[model samples]
Target: MTAPEPTTDGTYRDRIIAVEPGGNEFIADADRHGRPSQLVWTWASPNLEFATIFLGVLAVAYYGMNFWQAAAGILLGAGLGVLAHGVLSARGPRHGVPQMVLGRLPFGFKGNAVPSTLMSITAGVGWFATNSVSGAFALSTLFGIGPLPALVVVVLIQTSLAFFGHNLVQAFERFAFPVLAVIFALASVAILGKSDLGAPAFEDGVGGLGGFLLTVGTTFGYVAGWAPYAADFSRYLPKTVSPVRTGFFAATGLFLACTTLAIVGAASVTIATDATDNPTDAFTSSLPEWLASATLLAIAIGAIAANAINVYSGAMAFVTTGIKLPAHIARALATVFFGVAGFLIAWWALADAAASYEAFLLLIAYWIGPWLGVVFADQYLRRGHRVEGFLYDRSYTNWPGLASFLIGLVVSVLLFCNQERFVGFVVRAVPELGDITFFVGFVLAAGCYLVFCRAKIEAERVAL
Candidate 1:
């Protein structure tokens, strides 16, 4: 495949207007053309939506944290999460492949299927449903419509965006950024003006050190969930783009968007009672009718923005797992199939948005923590090396990555997890530790992979 010729200004319009044809293929050098700074809006705009705001709300209302405490947790957790996200994003331009495709370097081509399959379900079905429910609820509130129909509307719009693929996704996000930023900014001002920042840290049996830890874990999970898809958007940047600059922009966008909105959500809780139960209503109830209506509309739009990434990356993950078909056809089919599935899940989740959302965020942490551990360890072991040769080499099967991931997942869930469904043994035995599963999983998986797989990975690199 020949790279498209660059315009005099160094921007390639064909890359943006053209529907990307290849599936999980390395981007040609000519096709790789865009400013690294575009990642700022590309990462930020979608996250500017309600799901992120709801996380802040979850911190205050559900975990019983006060505004200041919630803000602290959000800042710290989101800061750490986005740093990892930024580092991973730098890999995109260097490798010119989807994030999951690069997993083959660590997990082996066939073994990479394990994480790719899991990511497909998580992004396409799990997160898609989660955000769609929030959007549907916003529509229902704004129009007095039922959630099912609203969900259908949401699914159709986001799925279409994913069907068109990369350039459109980036364009849509860039277009949405300024509007979303202004609307959410207005909402934040209104919320902060009404909030009681000095409100007692613990109210109604909430806000202990344990609750604080839980809030941190939830916030980290919410932001870090984007880590697996980090490179998907960044791969289109020109190969010469500075990795540091690219990572900085991506991280800044994620950190700013998630932390700012989360703080808004937290502050909103101080003045709005029972906000956690129905976040859309709680958030909009305090605003004037016109602004409230506008905010609701923005939320629905935001869900579409977030889900565009989810569906697109999810489709990419599906294709990476050895699916055989034309890339465009596979992506289109995956978008439709997952859209329907997500709609059904969203419809069901609307019944208990607060509980369902909380569980979803924590569950995301459960798997993603271990996955990040393995991926980051592999990246470190490679030390800025490229892996073009390993991209399509299916014969290699790196059992170590798989074993490390499973071990970390199982051990972390069994011990440190503290959730609604089942408490881990350690958490049950000592309720004060909170949910430290993500931390435990990351450390364990990374340590295991380093000990067992690093030498083998280095040997393969030398052979290449």
Candidate 2:
């Protein structure tokens, strides 16, 4: 696990080509490497893909917001998520373990299984599937290949990167960053060049305040999807690294990439009315053929960049479930399993990419909001207390955390849900309210956890 000494040039580190060892275990001091600023590209490259762009597309194309309105939602939504990401990621170097593994502090090794299992499926399979669809579409368009075959190619590449593990993932992202950034920047210019920036909100669409809120939720959902995986990438940084720098670089990268691309997506739809039929193609339709082809390639590469982290962190989340297996290769094996599952799901989802993507994004927000509520609340309660032992304490249980999470989830979904599949009664009665389930869920869960866990957390602190 030993890493090479930092080079004078500040460029070299561990063998990026080697398969990373361990499964959600604490990264040893000898292995800890890299600076905080590098987190920028590590977070940015992934969001440069079409999946992120479609978030904006959904705002203008489906949710009926004008470009200006969509931009506002994108900023507000992505801004909040990015801020949370910075705060969460700042805890990584101190913990020196995968993000999900830290759940043991609040939920206990056993209770943490709930969120771990969900994240494993969500990040590994759900997000993997979601991003893969866009990548496959790009490949299919670029190569004239069938969607299924294109998906297979994309999945294999993404999974292989995850299977090899962290260093490779970081290196890939760094390599991908410049390429993705340049192409997306050019495409955005082209898209905006043809856009009607003054276009009004569509009358037939969701429209007005409801449309704005939904757009906000959707964009937040997109960024929130990355929240749980924050520390997984940063755990290898030296403990002395500045948490502020770590968070700032990561958040800035995510904010810039997601916000910029989403705005481009909103602008693209101003001209490409066929966005509903095929988002990826419609996005590139405004550019010249050569630039469009390059943009398509960038989109495919960006998807792979995003899913590398997805599958890797998904495996890390699964391992945090405390499931016994061949300890050495558990993460790698899980990566393979999830990769296959994601491919299948992606295949099924290709039939209706636009609808499926929108649903998946909002669903991510629903669960993640509550989970984050409990995590953040627990962290706040346990502040100034040394709770590292709890990370591996099987007997350590925090029933309050679990209770708060479930209560928040159930109550919010039953009251404020606004999805097409199942609108909550409250939302149904007031259709213009849109979805605030994620926000309500977070507040409820956090408030509940603070009330229920205070005495217990204090007692645990005193015991420590």
Q: Please give the clash total of every predicted structure, in order.
A: 0, 0
Candidate lDDT scores, in order, read 0.86, 0.88
User: Tens digits of per-residue lDDT for model 1 on 79-109?
Assistant: 8799889999998888778899889877887
TM-score of 1: 0.95
* Tens digits of per-residue lDDT for model 2, 356-463: 988988999998889899999988988889767677766778877898999999999999999877998899889898999999999999999999999998988887
Can you give the TM-score per candidate against the true fold? 0.95, 0.96
Best by TM-score: 2
Cα lDDT, model 1, residue 114: 92
- Prediction RMSDs, each to the true structure: 3.4, 4.0
**Cα deviation of 178, candidate 1, in Å:** 0.5
Error of 1 at 195 (Å): 1.0
